[model samples]
Target: MTAGETLRGLLELTRPVNVIAASVLTGIGAFVAGGVTSHPVEVVAAVVATGLAVGAGNAINDYFDREIDRINQPQRAIPRGAVSPRGALLFSAALFAGAIGFALVLPRLALAIAGINLLALVAYTELFKGLPGLGNALVAYLVGSTFLFGAAAVGEIGPAAVLFLLAGVATLTREIIKDVEDLEGDREEGLRTLPIAIGERPALWVATALLVAAVLASPLPYVLEEFGAIYLAAVLPANAIMLYAAYESFSDPTAGQSRLKYGMFLAAVAFVLGRAVEVVGAA
Candidate 1:
């Protein structure tokens, strides 16, 4: 392969956007969970560890989903023959090791979160993707747990639980929408996702209900006085995004559900802004 193709393939396997999101989520978690570290070095270490672990999960997920990707995503690194399966596995292992190694030096809390989350990452890619409700639930927890994991890295974050629940509900809602969109692809692999288990309309309804739950819960931080008025600056828009996501899910637009990915990111941004304001207001 050409050098450019090789480089692109490697990056594709890691899903850099997702990795960056994980790190960003970690930072938000760390900051809200405690106050981002007093030491910038520790903050860097935490983000690096979270990013590596996220990369490890993505690489291995591609390796395992190679056959599936060959049908659904023919241009992926493995499907395009840009990277060998064994090579991908090795990359995943190296990334996982680096993540854990980096966390080991940070703090005991980081170490524990790293190890448990790594295991969950492996299980998610390997075992859970094929299951139905359980898999969807796992993905939600895994995604939302990044918040808690980030919080744990710094110190005991009192408000982290509410954040976890809010994110988790939104994630589950998003995953269900994706399942409805991927009905044919998943059927080809004989995977029993929510849409396959029930029906598309029912699944969409479930997703819409969950989205409503998220919308209702989004105001909790402000209601509880965790964040200041500045948080509303970002969160209000994010809530609007979630509201649109609910409508989209209900309408079942032909396009697959990728829009909410950014919407979730926006919500995280709100949290970060709100948390910063909270700290500043307190100080």
Candidate 2:
């Protein structure tokens, strides 16, 4: 392969979008904890650590899944020969090292969270990915922990707690939907995902119920005065989109999951906006 192809493949292994999103979530956590200005260095460390960790996780997952990708995702970097499995593994190891280096400078709680997350990331594809519901829960926890990691870095995790729950539940719902979307491939691979353990429709129902609970509780931040009215306004639309996506998943899991991601992104934006409004109001 050409140098350009190799570079692209390496980047693809990192799943750059996910890395960026996870870093952003970490920043949101720090911002919500009211530490962005007061603890700028720690915030940067937390965000960088989160991005590196996520990149490492994705690269390693692709490495472990190279064989499965051949059947389910032939165009993936390793399966397509754009990147070798050994190269992916090495790259992931380097990323994990960088994540640890950054995380080590943070406070005790943040370091602890990072250590657990790094271990979880390394073990996910090999140990948990095939289990029914357990894999989804692990992935969800990883996603939600970014917020707590960021908050803990600044010595305050109180505000990020609600965000963690909201994000985790939403992620769990989406993970289940994704499993339903990949039911055929997972079945061929002998994987026992939630959708495989239960029926696809039933899995979607569980996903929908979980999302509904999250939607109902989305207003808690504003109600508790953790955020301002602007947060409520912004989150309402996000909640609506998510609810609609959950409803749509029954008919088209692929589209529904895609839309659900958009909704989740919107909700994250709402958190930032809400926090910003509160800061401005106080000013």
Candidate 3:
């Protein structure tokens, strides 16, 4: 392959959009904790570290899942021969190193979270991916931990606790749906994912139930006085979209998971807006 193609493949392996979204989530966590202004450097560090870690995780996952992707996603970088397995591994390692470097400069709590997350990312594909719900839960925790990591960076994790739970549960729901979408390849590979352990319909039902619970509890941030009316208003629509997405998953898992991601992004935006309103009101 040409140099440009190889570069593109390497970048694709990192899943840049996910990296950016995770970084934004970390930034929101710091903002919600009221540390963005007081702890600007730490917040930046946390955000960058989160992005790097997510990129690293994605790359490593692609490397480990190369075989699976050949069946489920022939267009993927590794499967398409855009990037070699060894190259992906080395690139992921470099990203992990960068994440660790940034994380080491943060507080003890943040450092601890980062350390655990990095280890989990490394172990996830090989050690946990075959388990039924355990893999999904681990991925959910990793996603949710970005918020806690940011809050910890500023020495206050309480404010972001609700966000962590909300995001984590929502992510878990999506992960399950994704498993259903990947059922064919997972079955062929003998991977015992949630959908494989149970029936596809049952797995989707579990996902639906989880999404319902998360939607119902989404208003807690406002009710608990952590956010303003704007948060409630914004989150209402986000919750609706997520619920609709969950309903759609039973018919078309691909569309459902994609829409669910959009809803999650909207919810994240609502979080930033709510925090902004509170900050403005205080000012």
* Tens digit per residue, CA lDDT, model 1, 258-278: 667667778888888887776
Clashing pairs in 1: none
Query: TM-score of predicted model 2?
Result: 0.91
Give a tens-digit lDDT track for model 2, residues 1-283.
Answer: 9989999999999999999989988999999888899899999999999999999999999999898789879999999999999999999999999999999889999999999999999999999988899899899999989988889999888658877877888899999999999899889878899998989988999888888887888888888888888888988999888889889889999889889888888888888898888788888
True-structure lDDT of candidate 3: 0.90
Pairs with backbone N, CA or C atoms under 3 Å apart (clashes), candidate 3? none
RMSD of each: 2.7, 2.0, 2.5
Instruction: Compare the candidates by TM-score and give the number of the best one.
Output: 2
Ranked by lDDT, the better of candidates 1 and 3 is: 3
Alpha-carbon error at 109 in model 1, in Å? Answer: 3.8
Which segments of candidate 2 are over 4 A away from where they belong?
Answer: 1-5, 80-82
